[model samples]
Target: MADGHHWNIVKIPPIVQELAAGVHEPPSQYMVGEKDRPAIAGSDMPEPIPVVDLSRLFASNGYGNDMVVSEKQILNWCDRDVLREYTVRCREITSLVLKKLAKLLGLSEGYLVDMFDEKAMTYARFNYYPRCPRPDNVFGLKPHSDASVITIVAIDDSVSGLQLLRQGVWYDVPIVPNALLINVGDGIEIMSNGLFKGPGHRVVTNAESERVSLAMFYTLDPEKELEPVPELVDDEKRPRQYVKVKTKDYVTGLFETLARGTRVIDTVKISDNLNEIVS
Candidate 1:
């Protein structure tokens, strides 16, 4: 049985392969804004890239009931039946992960979960990168940290393209079947008072095969003001490292300054206190 912690891969619907094979055109309908529309620079991408938004699949009034997402845009790429199955399983996984994270931080089991009330926003994106002849010359996806509190990625089991930069070196993320990769995002870094760092990651294309990935991002309500949790901050020891900012503003700034390996988090970083005299 698929539960909050574990998913029975065999029982879960296999829609990823179907969606990847079915998409032949770019996913312009699902773009969040003009900036989100995928672009290529000088033959950077030689194939069609489609993104399917699956956030509305679990809406209270069934798919397409959400005001933030368009029915036509979602229906353009996702099958209602398949998406229904996928959403249920993914939500369970997210809940379990949030509980675990809270426990790790020495908080109540529901501490993190409560932060994501009905006003919270959850976005799921399905990215398909087609095969490229000269894969070495082009990048599938550029390096950037996520803007959400947490991101869950379901990678293509057959092909590998995801890589992470750590300690000035790039390391490939192996493709493991039925395994999910969870990444801490900028929001988590702020909320955790910099205890968790959002790592930079990118994707590279393959010469012979196509790659597909599903990423689910959990974010706080856009109108909510975000800052470090008070419990995690100590005035003299672990002082606040970030300034408070509305979630919407932070996301807007992220898109305006999007770039490979760019750290949008730095823009809102709190400066060091100069009030104290130095010897």
Candidate 2:
């Protein structure tokens, strides 16, 4: 008899084992573009950012209080060391997630493990535009999909503003208390051979309150070449699309696009020399 639910205890991975075990650091300042940014929501709104506890993310798997992550710590991720530690934790959790997804997809566990090892990870913060006298005039965040493998988000539960693009329509994603939202990033789609999709999403701000979210980005390994898995490619009128790329060069290309403030994925440079993977 199966209850249809799989369970496993989770713990901090060895990559971040040293960092999380070290002394704590002071909180750093966090802000959006400016202090007096115009409002994106209407004047009647309160703060839109919600609160979440990522410390308990693996609690169900028995990691419990042994792993504690504070909201303030995530808010100040300017420290590269802190960001690195957070990224490691992100990959650790995502490894579990990828395994589960692989099982469902009938893919081998080794494949999933390899995918995790070949991935790059990073941590970033999304700050809601500050409250202005007028809300409709401002946009806290524009809709976009992360250009990575997977994205784990610990959002502020008190404020509700994250929306997902579904069937070409925007739908509000309710931020339940104490829950983290897992969204498939572009890389996952490529790895999964398009089985899982990276949907477009965005955040709206409250006229009087600020909204914040911490995003963990997991990327493909820079030394590896990425192409659609043959097993996942089936005949469907859609053409079999594959782009070869080196993960390091791919990421550098991504930063170049970000510097230009462009959201077009097509503009990203893919390495034709993807076969040059180093051992």
Candidate 3:
């Protein structure tokens, strides 16, 4: 991507994925007053990114060269090896994470890993916020929890806006520079029988500089059903805390609930547990 040569998106037609559904009127959520966009990949930009790619980045998904993605999930990009390696590494990292979480819950190491099949889906979402003159007026993202089993956010720039809700107040998440933030999602909370809780977070606009955050969402097959794992739910203390639902249905309901400005995890809970998780 450092090369000065520009690529045409008119031919391949890069993916124009929407971060939010139904409110698709030029992604005003990501807009800021036109200024200099800071370098996302750390220092030294050797060349200028073409207008087509830059517009796409500003239009929700382009990010200079969004050729790496499509609704089909497989575009004929020359640098496909990077995407392949990225997905493979994500699988390995998340698999290890699940095993550790399973052990933490006193369940078998492979217990949670077995739930996510080979056909499961993984998605990469990138949100770019240009330097805003009126930071108080705009919000980059609203307070919502992920619908996936886990969401890993790679902070690509120095500007800070991510914040988490705790107890009753919102706290800014400190930037660690090139660090990844691992978030517990709604699916994990269900599988753990409410032992784990998803976090509520939002992104406020920053007046200093531009920022880009790349989030990876890992989910089970759309057809797979999820519930409080049988091992975690017993006749004793830990009864079934979550209602069983297919992945597709839950995801559909998640979008709907988000649109309604409510947390979907609360809707799926059969018992009143961790009501403080997301509010």
Candidate 4:
């Protein structure tokens, strides 16, 4: 079993931290002193969070060793070598974690890996939350479930604010220095036939200290079909709890629904009787 302390040795690269500090975006709605600022759509926030698409670093063959960034600003500030090294390390970690998850779910070690094609998408976001005047009234981020297969979050251990909702209650996620937080996303829930739930989580703001976190999300090939594994579904025992859909379509719906303040997962969920009949 892997404990939080076990990941304490994996530190965030200094260049990544430097880039995060240099990339400034407009204040988010959650900040109390930003009342004078005009509200903007979540997607069009004045200062957009900096995101690096690791997939873009690869060539058409998907095995190229060279790394490149299309954004001039990012390219100028980031160290390409360091970025490549970090991306490679994160990819390896993701593969190992997926294999372990497969074993725990009684599936072949490569089962989940196959779902992620050579063109599988990997994204990293650098989140910087400024200190808020009234932390009690605002949240750093809204409550929502991740859309990827899995997410790895590395937080600035000096400050603590992450929380997850479980069984009608919200629990604080402890901050462990150098520790990585693993979150099961919606795709995993669909692939696992609802056996592994993607919990809803949110971030709270602090009155005194600002917070920084780096999150990497791993997703399957968009063109691939997403459905429950047959091995986990029995005609009479376990049933397929979600309808089959393309990964891209599911993700599109997820975002569309989120924009409307609703969840799309339930919309595709198979009802008890329907699930049994389909199985």
Candidate 5:
């Protein structure tokens, strides 16, 4: 997908000599260097060879990560356990982090995770964004925070699609090996009385290759009433910043608001007078 800006195409000619156009043997620049009089190449290879091409790569559109795409659906019914096991592991990690967050916010260690102990409403979504010719006109997912307490996402390393808004600028999310992206949700911001922030983020389609991302949302029991922790609010220092509401209602409202291209958090957020944010 396009970055924050748009790009126009520019044409350029190929190398000086096309093999069939007649410069017979390999050129001097083709050799390794003066050290290797004749670099052994072609035929059956014993080891991997190093090849470098700058102009060709730079002239290409989109990211120049030269990789072949899979022609078939690799995972099938036989991979059921793989999916189940992965979600289980993700839930376990989420529980651990929730417990730590509970303690960090001056609440009991089990405070956050306990809501899920009885009946958790955790779920996941698998996304596939196909390559688009005009990426700027379309978006995989619009800007919105997860309705759950926390969401953990993993994206394909070959292509990048996720972007987060910061100070009015949209920045592409780079893939970090061996790490998953964690997004704080509105629930956390409300529960913490605005101590934490749930950023606005979206997905941008790739112009060259298709992209895929997996996000797991950790939610509380549907019937549980969500609100700011009592300890976080006071008469002077910190007044309530968000209106109290049930998880089901909040979630339902989130979808309804999102469909209209609006943020539901703004509705719950208090304005000036007594409802204003604490200084």
Candidate 6:
């Protein structure tokens, strides 16, 4: 994809350490001087939350043939629904995304979750990091990937804090005014036999402002149970690449792995010579 002109990595301000605490820690948490500044909204405060629209989802193709919506539009819709109606819409979108991904990866429509033996759905989470008095001392969030099949993120353009790890370099992701970030998760990777890539991302604190972010996660039901699909394994290809396992077992295993100091997800076995990620 050609990079958008509007997207560019800006240098972090040099004076961030001296003026006030960074965005990671809220100013309300710590008292620095004789008199704490009264909290004021909109005085110079940027809107941390992003505003998204989802009308493009209902659009039909011209003559009902050549019409197709952009990927960003679907992401926007996913983000918007999560912000509005908590979980119902998320589940609907999750089903849709899984269906599309399954078709792309050559699985039966609705068979993606079946292979993993889980009920898939979507969810939205909001994160707001207000400015702090000590910007250099704290971080808004540590780098991590979503525990789901996919994660769609929409960040506030007013204040920047999102960053990504690429080739051992930390690059700030440009927060497009109304655009969304689509990232695949470990589950999709295992299901696709490693076709998609999950992003390694983290958030930082701004010295002068606050940052708001919304992330939509797609996942599977804890009880539906899962197993690796046989179609993904081939004798000519990577046969021992993964293991078959239940969805619930996989989710628990992932958390355990994290606690044990592993960031990248590994394969879990479902059946003989079949492995997959359970997210």
Question: Can you tell me which runs of candidate 5 are displaced by over 4 Å?
Answer: 1-78, 274-279
Candidate 2 segments whose C-alpha is farther than 4 A from its true place: 1-89, 126-128, 234-239, 248-279
Q: With candidate 6 superimposed using the best TM-score fit, by how many Å does residue 43's alpha carbon deviate from the native?
A: 31
lDDT of each: 0.71, 0.60, 0.71, 0.73, 0.70, 0.58
Better of 2 and 5 by lDDT: 5
Q: Look at candidate 1 and tell me the lDDT of residue 65.
A: 44
Stretches of candidate 1 exceeding 4 Å from the true structure: 1-78, 273-279
How well does each candidate superpose onto the true structure, as a TM-score? 0.70, 0.60, 0.70, 0.72, 0.69, 0.60
Model 3 global lDDT (CA atoms, 0 to 1): 0.71
lDDT tens digits by residue: candidate 6, 152-266: 7767978877766666556666556766666778777666656655666666666677677878877777665433356876656655344545556766776676544456455
| RMSD versus native structure for model 4 | 15.7
Location of the lowest summed lDDT over 10 successive residues in candidate 4: 36-45
Angstrom error at residue 164, model 1: 1.1
**Candidate 5 weakest lDDT stretch, 10 residues:** 36-45
Off by over 4 Å in 4: 1-73, 276-279
Q: Write the per-residue lDDT of candidate 5 for residues 189-261, one digit (tens) a residue.
A: 8888888778887777555677778888888788887788888887578888888788888888888888776
TM-score of 4: 0.72
Candidate 4 lDDT over 1-279, as tens digits, reads 366454446675575436545534424643334442212212222332344343443335755464324754554556768756777788777777787789889999988877777879887887887766656656677667888898988888898777776775666776666667778888889888889998887778766678999888888888887788888877677777898888789778877877665677787799986965666
* Tens-digit lDDT track of model 3 for 1-279: 598888877655433323222232335644433542221222222342222222222354534544234586635768668867877776766877788799999999999899888788888876887665556545667568888998878875567677776674566666665456778888999899889998887787665666888888899998998788888877557667778888878888888987666888888886445433321
Question: Where is model 3 more than 4 Å wrong at Cα?
Answer: 1-74, 271-279
